[model samples]
Target: MFAVTILGNNSAIPTLDRHPTAQVVTCNEQLLLVDCGEGTQLQITQYRIRRSKLRYIFISHLHGDHYFGLIGLINTLNLMGRTEPLSVYAPPELEQIIQLQLDCSGTILKFELSFVPLLPGYSGLILEDKDLRVSCFPTQHRISCFGFSIEMQKRKRKLIPEQAKAYEIPAAYFSKLQEGADYQRKDGSIIKNDWVTLSPGKAKRYVYCADTIYDVNLLPWLKDADMMYHETTYLHDLEDRAAERYHSTTVQAASLAAAAGVKKLLIGHFSSKYTELQPFLDESRPVFANTDIAEEGVSYIV
Candidate 1:
């Protein structure tokens, strides 16, 4: 279940066929909402996502297209009697904006809602848990924006069942062996854990580059990522406009993915002007062979 589901991928404007920026990062049984643009709640229901499984919300910035639906989503959770606590990570100003809306409406949420403010120009590890590790880094954009790198932790070691059986290990001790625990035989001989288990493979990483301008500073974070989502607000021909608006064009996003040597590239956050999306992949695949358009409602496994 480790994957990213695209909910909305358009830019500032919300067209009939496309909404704003929103996505769901699924890590095993946990669901993390990456952004909450307009109609995010509707999109969630449309995609049949279990609302109760959503535990964390991460807002890239305070832009309306990025977080305008936060209040509504939060309210809906309360209305649905969600007693479990929810955590939101976003730019510092977002807390105030959300609070004002809640205060004016005199709505006290039924669930405990907590907010973790991300400072402007901040970069470093922000969250670490049993199954996931998340870090934030700055991106060149019109406003203070941040990109997130999500790594799905592989805690279990690779177990060699044949090797374990040859060593006369009991089936009941297999789980402990996979957890790197050594086995002691009846004769009091200790079988080293490494004799039957190997270190887990590299963790799978997903990098979400929120709205950003063309900048190579992000490579350090994006390098060798399993999958990366970069904004492509315009076609290559509109490079000038993209730079001026502090957004990225198709070529820019693809080139970065190529330079970073990421396994797969997902280009989205399209400008409202472009109704045709195939051209994005058409243009990107030339630079990065494994590029795909981040279509809404599709889930990209990490």
Candidate 2:
């Protein structure tokens, strides 16, 4: 059940048909909001996402398009009587920005809110829960931005009931066997864990490369991901303009995905100038065959 739903796929400007950057990463029953752009709360409702299950929020940078919706979303949660604590991970300066907005409005949240500042160039594991592990890496953007790598942890080994029964292991110990525990029979003989259980499968990873210019250093983080979201803010023909704006073009993003060997690539954060998105796909597919447009409201399985 690990998947990411695209909320707003467009770049800086909110067009009539497109919004800014926002996404909902669902890991089992919990949801992690990534980049709360303007109208994100409305987008969440429009997509029928369970906002109550949201436990964490990650902001990539100080860009207004990436986090302008934060205060509004937080205020809405409070108005809706949400009680669960919410944790936000973002740049150190965001704490003051959010606090200023809250203070000016004199709005006291009904739930606990915690902030974990991501200092400049910080990279490594930022969060680990029972179902998911998330890490952040710096990206080359106009501001200090970050990319998130999310891995869904498969904690339990697969148990073979027939093998367990043949070993005369009690049914009550089945859970323990699934947890990779070896069993000691009454006769004091050991049944190795591998005899009855198989190792957990490789974890599924989803990497989100927030706004960034083409950078090869990200290969380590992007390599072999089950799915990756990379911004393609302009078409290939606009390469010069994209570089000038510190953004990526379709070909640049697709080429990187191809080099990284990610299972699939999602390209979004389109510039408002492009009314039709087909050109983006037309330009990227040749470079990366598995690339897909990160269309709003579509949930791509990790």
Q: TM-score for each prediction?
A: 0.98, 0.96
Q: Rate the local accuracy (lDDT) of all candidates.
A: 0.93, 0.95
Q: For residues 1-302, write the lDDT of model 2, one tens digit per residue.
A: 99999999999999978999999999999999999999999999999999899999999999999999998999999999999999999999999998998999998888999999999999999999999999999999999999999999998999989999999999999999888899999989999999999998899999999999988999999999999999999999889999998899999999999999999999999999999999999999999999899999999998
- Record all residue pairs in model 2 with backbone atoms less than 3 Å apart, i.e. clashing: none
Cα RMSD (angstroms) for every candidate in the order listed: 0.8, 1.5
Find the number of clashing residue pairs for candidate 2: 0
Instruction: Looking at model 1, report the run of 10 residues with the lowest lDDT sum.
Output: 136-145
Model 1 has a clash total of 0
Write down the lDDT that model 1 would get. Answer: 0.93
- In the range 1-302, model 1's lDDT, one tens digit per residue, is 68999999999999998999999999999999998999999999999999999988999988899999999999999899999999999998899998999999999988999999889999999889888999999898888999999999998999998999999999999999989899999999999999999998999999999999999999999999999999999999999999999999888998999999999999989999998999988898999999988889999999
> For every model in order, what is the number of clashing pairs?
0, 0
